[model samples]
Target: MSIIQQMNSKLANMIAAGEVVDRPASVVKELVENSIDAKATNIMIEVIDMGMGSIIVTDNGMGMDFLDAHLAFDRHATSKIMDESDLGHIMTLGFRGEALAAIASVSKVTLKTRQENTEGIEVIYHGGIFVKDGTSTLNQGTVVEISDLFYNTPARFKYIKSDLAERQAIIDIFDRLALAHPNIRLTLVMDNKTIKSTYGTNDFYSLIDQIYGSKMTNGMTIFEQTVQKIHITGYLLSPQIARSRKKDISVFVNGRYIKNYKLVQAVIDGYHSFMMVGKYPIALIHLEIDPSLLDVNVHPQKYEVKFVNESILAYYIETYVKEALLKQTHQIPETLKNISKGLDETYIPLNLNFGEAVISESKPVYETQNTEKTPKLPDLEFVGIFSGTYILFQNEEGLYLMDQHAAAERIRYEHYFNSLAHPNPAVKHLLFPHHLQLTSDDISVISNHPKKMNAVGFYFNEQNDLVGLPIWLNDSEVEIAIEAMVSMIVEKDAIDLAILRDKLAKDISCKGAIKANKALSLSEINSIVKNLRACENPYTCPHGRPTLIKLSHHDIERMFKRVV
Candidate 1:
């Protein structure tokens, strides 16, 4: 007998399905792409049980006929692409015909479509095998329903997350799609509740205001630039309105949301000097270029793209955004002054509570000549604590409120990170081992890097389908920590040991740290300050939010009209 043989058709299709149908979110993405390709003016997505039980997508577009509906579930049967040359200049959202076929192989699928000139038809397929085919009386549109997702593959089904998490993923996908197509009215319903519904408006600014709040809209500056064959148009938020996370930045290329790090970095670099450290500004950027210049088939999910002239594109993006920001600085509108002025309003002092003031002007003595011997730590005197969360402090320059938890998280992250750099570090042993059940793929990935985990104070034992977790973690939080760590490792193949260690440490720290409502003693406040001063990057936390913000005496005086 031959050692090697061709796999069966069913097995081959299941393997392909593994690549495309990763979760309910993946199914939603494929169906939405098909709706966009069909030139749908209005799209609606409804899900039950967070899309694990059922997903229904209805669109008002030029629907397919009976023959086309049957061929849609066949591999390599796409109306978008016919010849090999068509791949070079692809304009449609989905070209490869693997979506429906791959999705059908893993779940029970029902497709109903009707064209303007033909009667409606319905087809049902289960596990890539046809179950029922017949004409159906329906409205003048297309509706595709997918149920029992990943049912055939028990291993994949086991990895489905909580309903809340899956719903979040679906919302994220819908947000991206809505941002790209502002003119297409879209409605998303989950478990009989309307999550999002948008009117088909051509006004981009109105759409931005709806998605992001008024704060983002107030800081937004419109920009449009065209260089050679490429056109760029979008909104860039002012540096003053910055966020601590990258979730606010949205970028779309030719109506497709992508995660190109190089492009995002280029845009950030353009706003270099205007933004404060650890702050990221919001952006809604759209880029248009010749279809042949970009390739979107690089990733299985189509979230990443490869460009032919990346260098040139990067340059144009940087230059255009930089110029736009520079020009806006000179265009601040002046308030119109009344010629016939009434009596000048008297200044009234509002009873403002300036929390605990620890550092009074009389506290510590410092001699300039003694600076040569040993640099003294700044005399950060405590003011008053605010809302039991922020620690108000005063120094020679200004008043600052320090977020104790954020500061502690940063300190722990740096310490844990530095410990990982050493050859031998302390590893706290668990008194009782914790068992974690994971998918086979996750187990394979974890097994491949046992040494890396050992370096970061984690030990695991694989037996059957469960992995034994370290005893250091509490029994309740062990699952969450493991899941987070596993997700991080899978997303970033080569795990930076330091980053992993810090992430784990931060996760542990946040849970045990004092909450905002908790009252603190004077000693506790002092301890927070001491720990913050020890941190390498004391200004920002691990999540990149400013730990402390300063308001100088000079600024106070200016605000009070005491100084120019």
Candidate 2:
């Protein structure tokens, strides 16, 4: 016998099942795509036991006849593509013809489909073996039910995650499908409870509202630009509406959801200076390109794609997204305007709750230091402090809101960082000694770093108390701040000098800054403003919160409806 003999059809299908039907979500994806290819206007997905027990997908599309329904179970049987040339211009979501056969191999499947004006046909299969085929009365569409997924493959079943995890996977795929085809009315029901529903109005914004609520929808900015045959259109969420993960960023190419990290980075780059580190913006980017220039067959799941001129495409997306964000500043919605109008603009503190830092009568002991001259930001006329927390200013360019605490934190961080870098050997003794009790190990750790601590302005006494405290901290807060520093040092076995210095600077800056709800005079506000303007990066505090936000003149006019 030849060593390389052809495998049996059943064995061949089981191998294909390894790729096509990895999980319950994979089965859902294949069936729903088939329904979409059939031009389904409304589709419904129902699941039980997190789709491990059973999954049913029903669609109101042009269904198949008896012969076609029977043939559908056969491997490589497809109505999507006819010849080699047809592959270049493939538009339908499903073209491989392998989904149905692969899906049938590992699980029990019951399919009922009826063409318009034709009698419905029901077919049954258990582990790719034909069980029964007969006529049935049904609506004009297709219904596929899959049960006991991966039953034939115990190894795959053993690796499956918990029920909750599997359900999340299913939900993720459904979200992508809904985003890609916003015109299709889609509903998902898990364990008899409806979790999602879309009206199929062909309005993408409405779909966004349905999925992420009205707040996110209102914060979104629309972007559209065409470069050659590639058409890019989508919405970018404002920086304020950011998430910790990239899960909210949705990208589709030619109506198929895909994962392209480079494209994702391009989208992030679009936010540029507007976004803080480790935060991702919500994106719904759609790309329409000639099928020939794009390749979607690389991944088994087809969630990744390859296209020509990727760099150029990324640049185009980045450029337009930047433009859209710039325009967003000048286009505040009426709802936001109405709310802003009710508030007193001159002294609207806007709730600046920066942590537990207290306001003390003692002032910061420092001289205004010189700075290297850089490009100057436009000067603003002081309008006084809002809520005793924010510094309000206005000029020809726009209205500016500066977080009092953040500005001081930024200034203190830079001041301490520079002092540490140059090693200022100045220690001012306090009139009253500060005391903190700690474990022996913590006391030993602090003793070892006495010089290092003193360098950062904390001189320790023999009794684990501070001989002198940092000038920045209030008398009452010095013990807590010293304990925090001691705890930080204790947590690490050995600390890098640079890392230690940075940590010290950060702690001191946070504790020393002016707190929210603390009143400030005009001279104090001017001093902070002037010092902030002189810093290298005064946009955000050391902790990465924006120190100031500008409401442009154009935005003010737009808010008042002075011009359309």
Residue 454, model 1, lDDT: 61
RMSD of 2: 16.4
Worst 10 residues of 1 by lDDT: 334-343
lDDT of each: 0.69, 0.74
lDDT (Cα) of model 1: 0.69
Predicted structure 2: lDDT: 0.74
lDDT of 2 by residue, 1-564 (tens): 768989999999999888988888999999999999999999999999878889999999999988889899999899999987887777888888899999999999999999999989999999999999998878999999999988998998888776545766787788889888989999989889787778888787788766654545666799888997899997887665544457768889989998888888888888764553445677888999999998777866788778889999988888888788767865543323322332334332221122222122133322344445542446979887666557789998999988876778887776666555644545668676665533232454577678757766778778776788655444644543554455455444334457655665666576444222235666567667666666667888888999999999899899999976
Runs in model 2 lying further than 4 Å from the true structure: 1-5, 331-354, 357-564
Provide C-alpha RMSD values for all models, in order. 15.1, 16.4
TM-score (all chains, Cα) for each model:
0.64, 0.64
